[model samples]
Structures are given as C-alpha cells and as structure tokens.
Target chain A: MTFDWQYIVDALPHYKTALWLTVKLATIGIILAIIVGMVCSIIQYFKVKVLSQIVQVYLEVARNTPLLIQLFFLYYGLPKIGITLSGELCGIIGLTFLGGSYMAEAFRAGMEAVTKSQIETGKAIGLSNLQLMRYVIIPQAFSYSVPGFGANCIFLLKETSVFSGIAILELTNTTKNLMGIFYKTNEALLMLVIGYLIILLPLTLFLTWLERRVRHAEFGN
Target chain B: MLNSGISVLFEGVNMQRLLLGLLVTLRVALIAVVISIVMGILIGIIRTSKNKLVQIPFRLYLELFRIIPILVWLFVIYYVIPANFDLNLSAEVVALIVFSLWGTAEMSDIVRGSIISLPKHQAESSKALGLSVAQMYRYVLIPQATKRSIPPMINLITRMIKTTALLTMIGVVEVIKVGQQIIEVNNLDHPTISFWIYGFVFLLYFVICFPLSRFSRRLERKWAT
Candidate 1:
C-alpha cells in the first residue's frame, strides 16, 4: 500500500496533544523520581536501620518487574483496596516507582565513589556530619552522577510511551486508536515512530552533550 | 470462599493457563537472549574496529534502539512491516525479532566497552609474542571480554525477560494477557479479581528475575577484584 501523508497531516493535532501530555507526565515523573531516589540513596548510604531495609525491598520490587505490570497493578489492582487513582496519576506513580529505584542506584554509585579518605579528611578538619554531607559529599557525588541523571531522564521519557497502557491518550495510544479507526496502519505507525524520534532524538543528543560537558568540567581535558 | 478474589486465580484452568503464558514469555526471552549473545559477540568484535563507516552505522543503530521505546518498535515491526510487505509474521516471531535486535544492540555495546577497557599491555604483549590479530582476539581479547561481559549480559537477559511483558499489547498470549482473560471471565462474580491476578503475575516475574539479578550482582562483585 502507498504511504499517505494526508492521514499524518490530519492526525498532527492529536499527535501534538499526545506529545504534550507525554512530556508533562515524563517531567513530573522524573522530578518526583529524583526526590524519591535521593531519599533512598541517603538512607542506604547512612545505613539507616529499618528504613534502609524498606528501601532495599522497594528497589528489588521496582527493578525486577516490568513497568507494564506495575501500571496494571496501580490502575486496576489498587481500587479493590479502596484506593483509586486517575490514569495520569497511575502513570506518574508507576514511572516514579520504577525510576526511583534506578535513580537511587545511580546516586548510590556516585556516593560510593566518594573515597573514605575524603570523609576522614573532612572529619579531621572538624567538619560535622551534616557539614561533611552538605559541603563535601553532595557536590562531588552529584557531579559524578551527572551522566547517570542524564541517562535516567532519557529513560524515564522513553517510558512515557508505556503510559498509554493505563489508558492515557499519549502518543502511542493515540496512534493505536487512529490505526484502528482508519485502518491506516502504515501511516499511523510511521507517525508513531516519527513522533517518538521527534521527542527522544533531540533529548538524547542534548543529554550526551551535557554529559560530555560535565566530564570535561570535572576532569580537565 | 469460592467467590473470594484469590480463589478466582485458582478457578478452573486459570492457573494452568497463566503458567502456559509464562512459558510463552520465557520462550521469547530465552530465544532472543541466545540469538542476541551470538550476534552480539560478532558485532561487538567488529564494533572495536577502527573503521568509521562501520562505527557510524552501528552507533546510529544503537542510538535508534536506545532512544525509541521498545513498545513503539514493537508496533512498527508488528504492524507497519506487515502492512507494507508481502510477508506476515506471527506476534511471537515479531516479539522475538524486536527483543533480539534490541538485546543485540545493548549486548554489543557492553561487549565493546569490555574489549576497549582492556589494558594496553595485553594487546601489546600479544602482538610482541607474534600472534596474528585473529589469533590474538580468539585467545586474548574474546576470553577476557567474555568474563567482563557475562554479568552485564545476565542483566540484559533479565531486562529482556521483563520487557517481554510488552508483548501483551501486541495480542500475544503472555502472562498478562492470560491474567486479563481470567480477570474478565471472573469479573461478573468477582470484581476484585484483578488485584490478585495481577499480583500473582508480579510474583511470577519476581520469582524468575530476582535470583538472576542477585546472581548478576554476585558475579559483578566477585569479578571486580
């Protein structure tokens, strides 16, 4: 079958709206993930007793299962227990739940790379525990984790495509609906791939550039 | 007791069907992982070459797979190709192709990184011993890189296994689909059946993946020293 540009043209408005929702959801999800991740990493880093154990369980549960099942659980499963969430909320929560574990691992890696000598030196200088964290550890840990954060951001954004599973009319869902309606599978799928590339390609390029810049800044090229 | 949510999963052949679905899921992942490992080693070795033409195309391939979500790739391959081409592939075949291709891209990069990160002396010493390039790779590079690549490759297998859940969207009768079917069949009598069914599905995945991840972590730690 010949490819039809007209169907794509007609579907442009839907794609635009879908793209906006995807971006908004992904942004909110990533920001929340950073917050959740930071807390978990800090708890684990400091070796908090019961809380660290909880975070460990959360990490394994989040990391091992697929986001699709997580979304299904949140959207379809939770209501039985008298807790109901909107589709968008389910998408955001699922993204955060998965992204948080990954982001925490990234942060943990960065934090662990901070040598014991540096901590000893900070203590020798009479820096308090809080001060050591604020002035000594956080900055270096964050800088070291710059590439990880960039990678996680791109990952979370690409994950937004799965948001459609929760009945969010994001790009994938919109494209699927159009294909079903018009029976124009080629046009719809083309637009769907292009729609994702349009969103993710530039973000990937920007992140790679940022990562390089951060590396150069950290260690003199 | 029979009307309870948990009972819904056990009613009739539902549990058996879910197990069958799990088999499909594992089948896809296992086949894809095998294909990915073999192809990934070849591509990984080639990727270490100093040829720009080869490098650029593989880089694009890697980026394309990285940036695009697998579900979108699933759609394009499952729907787009069949619509345009004369050939028709089953959903299982499509899932295999997409996962294998994605796995290969990821696996090759891991292999390439391991190979590139080898100490300079290993290559120099091998050359000094008058080993040909192919012999050097066969004896020196591949063996060492295999050790480094194993943990990440195990991680990749877990990822592919997790990713096989997306096949449900393509109408593959995977675990999620089977659970959904059971949930639908039991919906009239049991409204809360989804929670148990989906929970069971989650546990199924965990049972398979958790040990694998633990093993990978152990390997990483053991091999690091």
Candidate 2:
C-alpha cells in the first residue's frame, strides 16, 4: 500500500483535537506527579514514621502493575465502590499514580545525593527545617533530578496512549478511529507514528540537553 | 454465594480460559526475554563500536523504539506489516515480534551504557596484553558488564510481563482480555462481578511482577555496594 497523505489531511482536525487532549492530559498528569512525588520522596528521605511505609507500599504497587491494569482498576473497579470518574479522569489518575512512584524515586535519590555538609550548614545557620528545604534542599535536588524527571515525562507521554483503552480519544485512540473510518491502517498508522515522533523526538533531544547542562553545572564543567 | 465473581471464576470453563490466558502472557514474556538478551548483546556491541556508520543506525533504531509506545508498535506490527506484505501471522505471534522489537532496543541501550561506563583502562590493558577483541569481551568487558546488566535486565523482564497486558488491546485474549470477556458476559446478570474479576487480574499481575520487581531492587542495592 502506498503512503496516503490525503487521509492524514482529512483526519488532521480530529487528530489535532486528539493531540491537544493528549498534551493536556499529560501536562496535568505530570504536574500532579511532581506534587505527589515530592511529598513521597521527602517522606522517605526524612524516614518519616508510618507515612513513609505507606508511601513505600504505594510505590511498589504502582510500579509493579501495568498501566493498563491500573487504568482498568480506576475505570472499572472504582465504580463498584460507589465512586465514578470520567474516562479522562481515570486516565489522569493512573498516569499520575504510576508516574509519581517513579518520580518519587528520582527525588529521593537527588535528595540523598545532596552533600550532607550543605544540609548541616543550613541547620547551623538556624534555618528551620521547612526553610532549609525551601532554600537549599529542593532547589539542588530538583536540578540534580532533571534528567530523571525528563525521562519520566517521556514515559508519561507514551503512557497516555494506553488511556485510549479507557475511551479517552487521545492520539492513539484517534489513530484507531481514523483507521476504522478510512479503512487504511497504513495512512492512519503512519500519521500516528509521525505525530509521536514529532513530539517525542524533540522532547528526547531537549531532555538530553538538560541532562548535560545539569551534570555540567553540578560538576563545575 | 454462587452468583459472585468468585463463583463465576470457579466455573470449569472460565477457570480454564483464565489459566490459558495466563499461559499466553507467560509464553510471550519468556520468548521476548530470551530474544531481547541475545539480540541486545549484538546491538550493544555495535553501539559501542568506534565506527560512526554502525553507531548512527543502531542509535536511531534504539531511539525510535524508545520514543514510541509499545501499544503503537504492537498495532504497527499486527496491522501495518501484514498489510504491506504477503505475511499473515497469528495475533499472538505478532505480539511476540512486537515485544522482542521493543525489548531488544531497550536491553541494548542498557548493555551499551554499562559497557561505555566502564573505565577505558580495562580495554587498554587487554589490548596491551595482545588479547583479541573477542577475547577481551568474552573475558574482561562482558564479564564485568553482565553483573551490572542483571538488575536492569530483571527490571526489563518485569516490564516485559507488564506490557503483555497490552496484547489484550490487540485482540490477543491474554489474561486481561479474558477478564474483560468474562465481565462483558456477566455484566448484565452480576453487576459486581466485573469488580471481582478485574481485581483478580490485577492481583495475578502483581503476583507475577511484584516478586521480580522486588528482586531487581534488591539486586540494585547489592550491586551499588
């Protein structure tokens, strides 16, 4: 089958809508992940009481199971317990939950990697715990974890495709839809791959740049 | 009691279907794991080679696979390839190819990273001793790298099993799909059954993957020290 541009052109409006939905979903998911991740990682780093153990369990469960199963649980299982969520909302929850677990690990690593003396010096200066974290700990930790966060973002973008299973008409779902309408998998699939490449390719490049910059800054390169 | 999802799961036919579906998932994961290991090593070698020509294409292959989601790759393997050629394969077999394609690229990068991260002195010393390229890798480089590769490889295996869930999306009737089928067949009669059945699927995946994930973490800690 020859490559078909006409179908791609015809499907652009729908595809554009789908692309925007995907970007919106992923952005929201990533932002939520950053919040959840920061809290979980800080708890672990500080060795907080029962809360840290709870965070550990959450990380294990979230990391081990497939995103598909998590989506199924939120989309199908939650309704049984007297809660209901739209498919897009379920998608966001699953993405954030999984992405958060991974991000928490990054933040934990970054937090621990900060020089012990730096923290001690902040305390010597009479900085309160919260102030220390705000001025010193979080800034360095986040910068050190820049590459980790970038990887999580790329993973999140791909994970958004699975949201299609829950009836979210994101990019992958849009491709499936276009294929059904046009009866040509070639065109739809091609456009889908290119669409992903367009976003992911550049994202990967920028992430590498950020990673290098972070490492350089850290090492005084 | 007899109307519950557990009761439905205990029905002989349903039990057999779920078990069979689990087997399919395991089969896919095992085959993909083996293919990824062997193919990944070869790609890793090329990736670390001094030749730019060899490096660029493999790097592209690696990145392309990395960027695309496994499900999208599965769709392309299952639908687009068959349409382009005179090839007709079972959906399950197509699923395996997709997993291997995804896994090989992933595993290769892991291997390449470990190799490149090694001190250059090891290879230089081996060269000074007149060790052949093959001999150097077989004895010195690979032996050290393999240890580093294991924790990541285990992580990759867990990921492999997890992605098998996506096969359900492509009509493979894997474990998750079987659970969905049961839910669909029972939804009208037993509204609560979907919850139990799907929850069981989640548990099954946890049982299969969690141990592997734990082991990988343990390995990571041990290796770090």
Candidate 3:
C-alpha cells in the first residue's frame, strides 16, 4: 500500500485524453444549458401560457433526481423507445437537462429581483415593452444573477463526474480504469483529486474575483 | 408492449426489494443528516470564533468538499483509507461517513450564514440588556438562527437524499442499485424494462423530495412575511 508515482506517470496520457473529453463535454453541456435556461426563464418571467407549467414540471423532476439515474434512463432506457444516444451525447444531454433547470431557477431569481419601480420608470419614459425589457430588466438581472450563474457553472462541471457511469472516458472513469489495470488505487486517486483541483481551483478563484467585481460595481465600494 | 414493460415491477419480490432498498437509502440519509446537523452546529459556532487557526482549517474543509465531487470522496474513503490504515468498513459505513462529512460542511456554512445575517442591533440590544455572552447566544441568537436556517437545511436534506443515489457506484444496495438489479434480471424478457424501472426509481426520489422542497419553500415564504 506504499505510495507509487510511476503509476500516475504511466497513466498520464490516458488522464490527458480523459480530461479533454470531460472539458469538451462540460463546455458544450453548459452552453446548451444556458440557452435552455434563458428560454425557460423568459417564459416564466413573462408568465407564458402553458409553457410555464411545463417548465415547472421540468424543473421539479430535474432538480429532484440525481444525474446518475437520469444517465441510466437516457443511456439504457431510451433504446427501448427506439432512440439511441452515444455515450458522449448522453453525457451532454444529461448535463444539459440537469443544469438547465438549475440555471433557470437562478435566472428567474435574478429577474424577480428587479424592482417594480425600475420597470415603471422605463414605461414612464416612453419605452416600449420590448425596449423596457431590453433596456431596464435584462442588464440589472444579469448583474444580480452573476453569483448564481457562477455557482451553477461549478455545479455543472462537478456533475460531469457522473458521466463516467454512462461509459464516457472522463476523469473518474479513467481513474477507475487505471486502478483496475495497475492495482494502484492510491496513486490513481491522488492524481484524480489533484487533477480536479487543478481544473477547479482556478475557476473558483476567478469566479470569486468576478463576484467581488460585480458587487463593488453594484454598490459603489 | 406497455403492459409488458409495466409487468416488471409486479414480478416476484421485485417491488418489495425496491422498497427495502429505498428504506436503506432513507436510513443512510437520515442518519447522516442528524449527525451532520449536530456536528455542524458545533462547528458553525466554533467557526465564528475570531481565531485565525480555527477559521482557516474550517475554511479549507469547506472548500475541499466544495471543489471535489462527492464520488471521488466516496472512492477515497471506501478504498484508500481502509487499505492504508488496515481498517475494514462496510459500504454503508463508507457511504455514511462520506455523506456526513459533506453534509456537515454544508450545514455549517448554512448555520454560519444565518448567524452572520442577523442585524447588528439585535446583538447590541441583547448586550445592552445585561445579558452575558452565553446567555445572549442561547436566548437571543441561537433561536433566531435556527429558525432562519431551517428552510435551507430542509433543502440540504433533499440534496442529501438525492446524493445517496451515488451510493450505487460503491455497490451499496440502495434504490438505484435495486432498480439496476431488477433491470438486469428482466432485460431478457422485456428489453424496455430499464425504462420502466429507472422511471420508477426517478419517481420514488421525486415523491420523497418534492414534498420536502415544497415545505421548505413554504417555510421560506411564511418567514419572509
């Protein structure tokens, strides 16, 4: 059970590929999630007819369920209905499905934080409905939502770990595969944790800085 | 076709097994939640101490849990520690330990947030009324903070429940694992059995979590007014 560095060195190339795949999947998933979130939030904000109820149901189901089961349903269950998704596609879709609802909640909270007086001010100034939303609501909402968006980004990235369950060769899967091959559980896992720290720590620090920047700009600190 | 897919749950002892597995999930989550709440309160109170030594370590602990995925923590505790320390623990034990550790970090943050968010005048008035420090906290702060923290804590409980699904990865016989077992046995006859089984597992979680989340939201709304 003594520590071994050579196993990590041996597994470095596989780790590299796995890291790339994880990054690629997470990036595409997050972009799509933001798009989904924006549309859902807009529907909710405007109280669009039937779509708001559909979004509510979508949010509840997505938020309550774990990504692993969702992946199982998508990867294993969907084939029963004649829809087959590749492992990578399943990973992306599951991530987007999960993340979109969370992002929608964040965006909705942001929109809700906009004051009624601000909207009235915009209306009183002869701004049309579209112009009011464009000029008054969106910017303030985006600024207020920065912290929530940052947290969701981190959450979505961490969730990509479950993509391994669907057979994607991501970081966790690569670590387990190496452990099985080399019997170097300690080294492989150490690298796995460190690899994630390497990826996440900088983003966290940057987000904290960005959050502070937004806060100061908002409050005149 | 729909009848055949639905028949998997009615098979021999399958429904019972899934319920037993679900009980195990709730058991693990409940135990972890209780332990985390008690320990988190203590840690949260300690964290408010103005000592850099105490605060720095707790900050590190929180960030460690926040930055890393729980799955990795599961593997580390389940595999690495037992091998290194010559200690053998069951999968359930490992799951409990990892989840409590994660939950404590989260709960402590919640506690810390609520404590700090109290108005400065509340503390000032309590002190001005000749209340001792302990008396002030016990009588004035703790009660208010606990009430403020309940909604978020309930939300955390729902999160912990959902997170227990990760236990299946470590081979814990939780609900999802039970669902997988059912699918394995029935896939030959009903190739669509997974859709039904996983769908049920999904609903099982939603049924448990939705009400809890709704309650939390209700409390949040009530308290806001």
Which one is best on DockQ?
Answer: 3
**Two-chain complex of model 3, DockQ on C-alpha atoms against the true structure:** 0.81
Pull out the clashing pairs in model 3.
Answer: none
Relative to the true structure, how large is the alpha-carbon lDDT of every model?
A: 0.90, 0.88, 0.90
Over B61-155, each residue of candidate 2 has an lDDT whose tens digit, in order, gives 88788899888998888888788897998899998888898899999999999898889999999999999999999999998998888899999
lDDT of 3 at A85: 92
Residue range B44-139, candidate 1, lDDT tens digits: 889999899999999999988998899999998998777778779999999999999999999999999999999989999999999999999999
TM-score of chain B of 3: 0.97
Q: Which of the two, 1 or 3, has more DockQ?
A: 3
Question: Can you tell me which runs of candidate 2 are displaced by over 4 Å?
Answer: A216-221, B1-3
Per-prediction backbone clash count: 0, 0, 0
User: By summed lDDT, which 10 consecutive residues of candidate 2 chain A come out lowest?
Assistant: A212-221
Worst 10 residues of 3 chain B by lDDT: B1-10
The CAPRI quality class of candidate 2 comes to: medium
Q: Compose the digit string of candidate 2's lDDT tens values, residues A88-113.
A: 99999999999999999889888888
Q: For candidate 1, lDDT tens digit of each residue in A1-221?
A: 78888878988999999989998999999999988998999999989999999999999999999999999999999897678999999999999999999999998898987777888999999999889999888777887888898899998888888887888999999998998899999888888888888888888888888877777655212
Off by over 4 Å in 3: A216-221
